[model samples]
Target: MSLKWVDVQEIAIQLVDSRPGVDPRFVNFVDLHQWVLALPEFNDDPRHGGEKVLEAIQAAWIEEAD
Candidate 1:
């Protein structure tokens, strides 16, 4: 399935799966944005991933990591 910026939980799961050893708490928005774009299932407009969306993704990822 394709992923959009609104698919925060799914994106977080994907991030956890893809970057196994990484800590989401230490991730910056810039890297988080790029990582979301790089996900194989992600298929949304890069411009649509704004700061708020990135923040949500990061928060979700942190939860998934825990």
Candidate 2:
């Protein structure tokens, strides 16, 4: 499933807002991905790559709003 840039931005912002100690500027997906990757638990997640994490977030978002 393809994701729009705005959608990615929105999701990233929401995630950043929800998490503790996350900077608001990390709404930028690339930065967000890099930040997330640094977290130990994320190493075990299948969506390890930046693109995959973005895609997975989009997919989960679609499922959640339905």
Candidate 3:
């Protein structure tokens, strides 16, 4: 099933509170960007998802494109 906006926000909050893979505090969006960068697809291109984690991994989507 597709996630609701609430679900997405909750996911973002969780990303902030817990370590999605490394550490919590995603610190800055840059940290989040770094995490994303370490991923295969993102590593291929730091701008793979454009700018936001939401957009980068939104059930295969992001919040912003650039």
Candidate 4:
């Protein structure tokens, strides 16, 4: 399934799956944004992601990681 910046949970799941040992809490927004874009299922407009979106994604990722 295709994922967008708005698909926070799906993106977090993908992130946790892709980087199994990584801690989402320590990830920077720059790296997080790039990582999300790099996900195979991600197909959102790159410009659409901002601090708020990144924050949500990070929060979801942290939850998924735990």
Candidate 5:
């Protein structure tokens, strides 16, 4: 499935798998945004994501990490 910025949960899951042992809690939004854009499955407007979306992804990633 194509991933947009709104697919925060899926993005988080992918991040968790791609970045093992990395702590999402300490990640900045800028890096997170770049990381999401770098995902092979991600296909959406680069300008679509905002701080809120990034936060949601981070939260989901943190949860997945646990």
Candidate 6:
């Protein structure tokens, strides 16, 4: 399944799986944005990922990490 910026939960899941042991709480938005773009299943416009979307992704990632 392809991932977009709207797919925050799924992206967070993928991030948790791909980057094990990494704390989402400490990750910056720039790195988070790049990481999402780098995901093999991700396919979306980079511009679509604004601060709100990134915040949602980070929140989901933090939850998934717990």
Which should have the higher lDDT, number 2 or number 4? 4
Clashing pairs in 6: none
* Model 1 ranges with Cα > 4 A deviation: none
User: What are the runs in model 4 whose C-alpha is more than 4 Å off?
Assistant: none
Q: Which candidate leads in TM-score?
A: 6
lDDT of 6 at 42: 100
Q: Write the per-residue lDDT of candidate 2 for residues 3-53, one digit (tens) a residue.
A: 343344445445544564644432455755655454333433425445665
Better of 1 and 5 by TM-score: 1
What residue runs in model 3 are displaced by over 4 Å at the alpha carbon?
Answer: 1-27, 40-43, 52-66
- Candidate 6 residue 48 Cα shift, in angstroms, is 0.7
Task: State which candidate, 5 or 6, has the greater TM-score.
Answer: 6
Indicate the residue-level lDDT of 48 in model 6.
95
lDDT of 6 at 59: 99
For candidate 5, what is the TM-score? 0.95
Please tell me which predicted candidate would have the highest lDDT against the true structure: 6
- What is candidate 2's TM-score against the reference? 0.34
Winner on TM-score between 3 and 6 is: 6
Candidate 5: minimum summed lDDT over ten consecutive residues — where? Answer: 46-55
The CA lDDT at 19 in model 2 is 62
lDDT of 5 by residue, 4-51 (tens): 988888999999999897899999989999999999999999888888
Clashing pairs in 5: none
**Cα RMSD, each candidate:** 0.6, 9.0, 9.3, 0.6, 0.7, 0.5
Against the hidden true structure, what lDDT does model 4 obtain? Answer: 0.94
lDDT of 6 at 62: 97
Give TM-scores for every candidate, taking all chains together and pairing residue i with residue i.
0.96, 0.34, 0.31, 0.96, 0.95, 0.97
| Candidate 5 residue runs with Cα over 4 Å from true position | none
Q: Is candidate 1 or candidate 3 better by TM-score?
A: 1
> 23, model 4: CA deviation in Å?
0.7
**Model 3 residue 34 CA deviation in Å:** 0.5
